[model samples]
Each structure stands twice: as C-alpha cells, then as structure tokens.
Target: MISSTAIAAPEIQHWQTKNGMDVYFVPAAELPMIDIRLTFAGGSAYDGDTPGLAKLTNAMMSQGADGMSADDISRSFEDVGAQFGQGSLRDMAFMSLRSLSAKEYLDPALDSFTKVLWKPDFPETDFKRLKKQTLIGLKAQLARPGSIATKAFYKAMYGDHPYAQPSSGTEESVTALSIPQLKKFYQKTFVAANGLIAMTGDIDKAKAKSLAERISSGLKKGEAAPKIPAVKRLEKSQRIVIPFPSKQAHVFIGSPGIERGHPDYFALYLANHPLGGAGLSSRLSKEVRDARGFVYSIYSYFSPMASAGPYIIGLQTRGSQVEEAVKVSIEEINKYLKSGPTDKELNESKKNITGGFPLRIASNSDIVQYLAVIGFYDMPLDYLDTFTSKIEAIDKPTLLDAYKRHVKPENFITVIVGGEQG
Candidate 1:
C-alpha cells in the first residue's frame, strides 16, 4: 500500500532553444542555489576509430577554455563557491555546475561553464600532462582483477560492437589519441542538435531560457547522432575464464537484456528487486551468500542503456568455490523464470519501492539528475510523478512474464577472472 500522503513529483518545464538544445527545468524557491547539467551526444560509443577520444576530449575541455588556464577557470568559480563537474559514459558526456542563485555568483559561474563546454581550448601543455595522467590511470586499472573481468565481460558480450569498448580507453588507444582527432570529434558530437540541459533550483523559466540560449548558440547546429544498433541476444551460454593470482575470482553472468524504452521496463524493474537489486534480502544474496556461504557477496541487475544493456549477476567467490557459485546463481535464476516472484515477495517489493520513491526527488540536486535522464532519453515529463503508481500496478503474473521475456538463464554468458576454477 502507498503512503497516506503521496509524494508529489516535481513539475518539469521543457523547451527547445533557438539552436535546438533541449532544456528541462524545475524551480525550487527554498534553495538559494541552482544546478545545471549539460549532456551531449559525445559518449564512449562515439569514439569511432579511437576508443578513448570522447572521454579524453571531455577531460581536456574541463582543464581550460577560451584561452583561460585551468587555474583561472577553477579559481574564478572557487571565489564564488561554485562547483563544476564533468564526465563521459557509454551513451553520453556531461558537465554540471552548481552556484548561488544570486547574480554575483550565477553570472560568473555560468560564463566559465558555458565557455569550457563549447570553446574548450585543449591547451597543449595541459593536454600532454592530462594524457600522461590518463595513461597512468589505465595502467593502474589493468593491474586489478576486477577491471580485467569488466573489460573481458563486455568484449565477450558485445563482440565487435561499438558498445563493447569501456568508457576509459585502453592504454594503446589513449596513447594514440591526438589533439586534431579530439577537435574533430568535438565539432560533430558537442552540437546544439545533440545536446540536452537539465536545471533545478532558484531559476525562473525566463532566466533558464536565456541561459539555455546563450550556451546553445555556441554549439554548431549540426544533426542529431544516429541511433545505436540493437544488441543481439546470445543463442547459447558461454563461459570465459581468465587466470589471475588473486585468491578470489570475480564471476559475472547473464545476457543482453532490455533497452531504455522496453515495453516491460517497469515490470522488469520491480521483479529485479527480489532477484538481486534489494541488497542483502535479494535472492542472489540469499542463495549464494546466506544459505550456502560460497561467495563474499552476490548481486544482479539489468542496465538499460541506448542499446539493450546487460542483465548481469556479479559475485566474487573463493577460487575453489567459483563453479559452485555460478551453478547456484544459474539455478536460482531458472527457478525465478519458471515461477516468478511469489505473491508475498511481489507485495513487499512494491511497498519497499514505493516507500522509498520520495527520496529520489527529495532535493533540488536530485531533481536535476532525474531531469537529465528524462531529457536525455526523451521520457515523458510525468515520469517521476507516475513512477510509484506504475510499480504498484504490476501483479505477480505480469512481473513473471516480464522477467521471463527479458532474462535468458539458459543462454547466460559468464566471465570469470582470477584464481583457477575447480
């Protein structure tokens, strides 16, 4: 049952700039601060022939812009207590700014942010320094077993697909990245037509519009990026094991699941709570950790991305227990597919999800984040408002059907790294 007083979802105001950048906005008079997130089409998948160019480009942009040194830009924001952040992922690259609503802070912060975003200088001295840092970071990651497993897992799942590459480019790929290549990538990817902005806090629609317009005008009014191809499901199960010296083996199992707008998204989401997403109470945790005690911890989830992302069950187990852990996880999943969640489990999951829904949009910053996802994915504005109702509407049969339709236990592809499997 839902709470007596339902949590009110924030009102979202959306519009298109003159140059075509989509903007999502919400006003909160209580906070004297604002958060602005700008998302672009420049993700790791757009790296083209160079694997890490998109991420490198994003990092370099933050270091300097419009002839200003990184220190100049940072110090300007610091003087006003503004915060800046930027990163790249598989499907999108983003930068965010937080500042006081007072014009004293807002104007200067926005100025630095907009320039860094659109007119990135990618200063040669800093570029070489940052590239060195990236290469060093990549080497450190390679020395870890978990990183090895994650890369191998994607490669095994996606084969030669663009999505196969991790967001952090491989060392060889990063070394090959050049200033010219990144500049060309920036021109096509960070365009008004492929951009989205999400903002929340003390800004009015008029002010939001003006800010959106100023930033959008800087981007070239290029075309939207092409759609990513759908992922093909694995026909049969395949397990790839890599030997490492660690005593614990990292095992990741499962197959291609749903994409962002899948018909069964809500149902699949609710069902996963019992299967894996609900922490210690999850089925994987219960069967693999509590009942048998073969694993350090076990969990699972469906990553719904632009393409059909993975439905993964991840666990780390003692070297000798790797086989047992994988066997039990598969067994639990097949059982779930056959019978779905029990009536009791379904009810509990609904109550738990709906109860915790309010926290998702509790703050201006949280609303800005949800706004970003909603805008980037072209979701309905009423998404947060209707989220709880949607989860509560699912029944046992519906939940079971959605899980069955998306998960393929029989065709699971498992990746095991570290230790020798017994």
Candidate 2:
C-alpha cells in the first residue's frame, strides 16, 4: 500500500519549437534556481565507422566556442554561478545547465550555453590534450579485470551490432580520429530536428518557450537520425574466458534484454529487483555473497536502450570459487525462470518500489532529467503520474510471464575474466 503523504506527480507542460524540437517543461516556483537539459539523437550509436566520434565531439563542446577559449567559456558561466554538464550515452548526447532563475544570471548562462552548442571551435591544442588523456585512460581500463570483462561481455552478446562498440571508442579508434571527422559528425548529428529540450524550476510558460527557441535556433535544421536496427537474439549459449592474474574473477552473465518502450519493461523491472537489484537483500547477493561467501558484491540489471540493451548479472569471486559461484547463480536463475516470485516477495517488492518512487522526482534537477528522457524517448506525458500505480498492479503471474518471454536462460552468454579457465 502507498503512503498517504506520497507526493503527487507534477503537471508537465509540452510544446514543440518552430524547428521541430520537442520541449517538456515543469514550473516549480519554490526554488529560485532552474535546471535545463538538451538531448540530441547523436550518441555513440551514430558513430558509423568512426567509433569514438560522438564522445569526442561532446567533449569538445565547451573547450572553445564563439571565439572564446575553454577558460573563457568556464569564466562566463562561473561569473553567473551556473553549472554546466555534457556527456554521451549509447543512444543520446545531452548538455545540462543549472542557474539562478533571475534574468541577470539566466541570460548570460543561456548565452554561453547556446554559443557552446552553435560555435564549438574544437581548438587544436585541446583536441591533442584530450585525445592523449583518452588514450591513457583506455590503457588503464584495459589492465583492469572488470573493464576487460565488460567489453568482452558486450562484444559476445551484441556481435557485429553497433551496440557492441564501447561508447568510449577503442585506443586505435581514438587515435585515428581527426578534427575534420569531429566537425562533420557535429554538423550532421547536433541539429534542431534531432533535439529535445526539458526544463524545471522557477520559470513561466512564456519564458520557457523563449528559452527553448533560443537554444534550438542555434542548431542547424536537419532530418532526424535513422532508427537503430533491432537486435537479433542469440540462438545458442556461449562462454568466453580471458586469462588474467587477479586473485578474483569477474563474471558477467545473461543476454540482450528489451528496448526502452517494450510492453514488458515494468514487469521485468519489478521482477529483477528481488533477483539482484536490491543490494544486500537481493537474491544474488544473499546466495552468492552472504550464504556462500564467494564475493563481496554481486548484482544484476537491465540496460534498456533505444534498441534491445543488455540484461547483465555481474559479480566477482575468488579464482578458486569461480566454478561454484557460476553454478549456483545459473541454478537460481533457472529456478526463477520456471517458478516466479512468491506472493510475499511480490508484495514486499511492490511496496518498496512504490514507496521510493517519490524520491526520483523530489528535486527540480531530477525532474528536468526525467523530462528530458520522456521527450527524447517519446514516453507518455503521464509517465511519472502512473509509475507507482503500474508497479502496484503487477502480480506474480504477470511478472513471470514477462520474464519468461523476455529472458531466456537457455541462450545466456557468459564472460569471465581472471581465472584458470580465463
């Protein structure tokens, strides 16, 4: 049962910019600050033959723009006490700004933000420095067991798909990247039509609309990116083991899961919590770490991207205990696939999930991020309002059905790094 004090979902205001960008706004007058996010359909998925181009392009955004050096851009926002953030994921690249709602601060912050989007200089000095830093980081990651396991797991699961490529491109790919390629990718991907804007906090509808227009106007008008192709399910199970000298082995198990808008998403989401997502109380944690003392940590999660993302169960165990840990995990998963959760487990999970839902949107910054996701993925406008109700409605049979249909234990691909087999 939900609490009486559960916060009601805020009303979202939606509109479209003249150049075809979708915008979602929420007015929260309680705070004197505003948070804004601009999302574009230009993540690593659009890298085409240039694997790390998207991440590199995003990294270059604030380095230099509108004839200002990176320091100048930094100073511009610092003067107004605004915060700037930019990053790329598998399916989207996003830029965020948090500033005081007053026009004195908001105006200058917006000017700097728009200039970065429209006039990135991609200065030669910054590019060389960043590229060198990326290579060093990649080299460090390559030596880590967890990183090796993650890359191999994705490669084994996705095969030749774009999802197989690491969001941060390989050392070879990063080294091969040039300024011309980065500029071309920026021109094609960062456009008005491919954008979504979300804002929350002290702003009126008129001001929100104006802000959206100002941001979108700086982008070139171009067509939306092509849809990512559907992922083909694996027909057979495979295990890949890489040799490393670590005392513990990193293990990753499972296969490609559902897409963002899949009908079974919520059902599977609720079901996964008890399995491995609930930290120390999770089934995987209890069985693998607590009961058997195999490792310090173990967890599972589904990364539902625009295309079918991975459903991964990850853990680390002493090299000597690797086989037993894998055996127990598989047995537990198979049992779950056949028999579903108990009534008590289902009810407990439901209450836990519902009770915590309010925390997700408790802050204006959090709300802005959620709004950006809704606009970018075309999720229902009432998504937040209906979230708790939907989770509460899930029953054991519905959850079991969704799990059986989406997660196939028979076709699992396992990756282990740092053990005898590895």
Top candidate by lDDT = 2
List candidate 1 segments past 4 Å from native: 1-5, 420-422
lDDT of 1 at 297: 89
TM-score, prediction 2: 0.97
Per-residue lDDT of candidate 1, residues 335-380 (tens digit): 9999888788888888888888898788887888899988888888
Model 1 Cα shift for residue 245 (angstroms):
0.3
* Per-residue lDDT of model 2, residues 1-422, tens digit only: 65823668988889989988888999999989999999999999888877889999999989999899999999999999999999999899999999999999999999999999999999999999999998998999988999999999999999989888988999989999999999998998889888888999898999999998998987878989998889999999999989998888999999999988788889999999888888898888888899999876899999898899999999888888998899899888888888877777788788788888898889998999999988887889998988888888888889999999888878999998996543
Give me candidate 1's TM-score against the actual structure.
0.97
- Cα error, residue 255 of model 2, in Å, equals 0.4
Q: Model 2, stretches more than 4 Å misplaced?
A: 1-6, 420-422
Our tally of clashes for model 1 stands at 0
Worst lDDT 10-window in candidate 2: 1-10
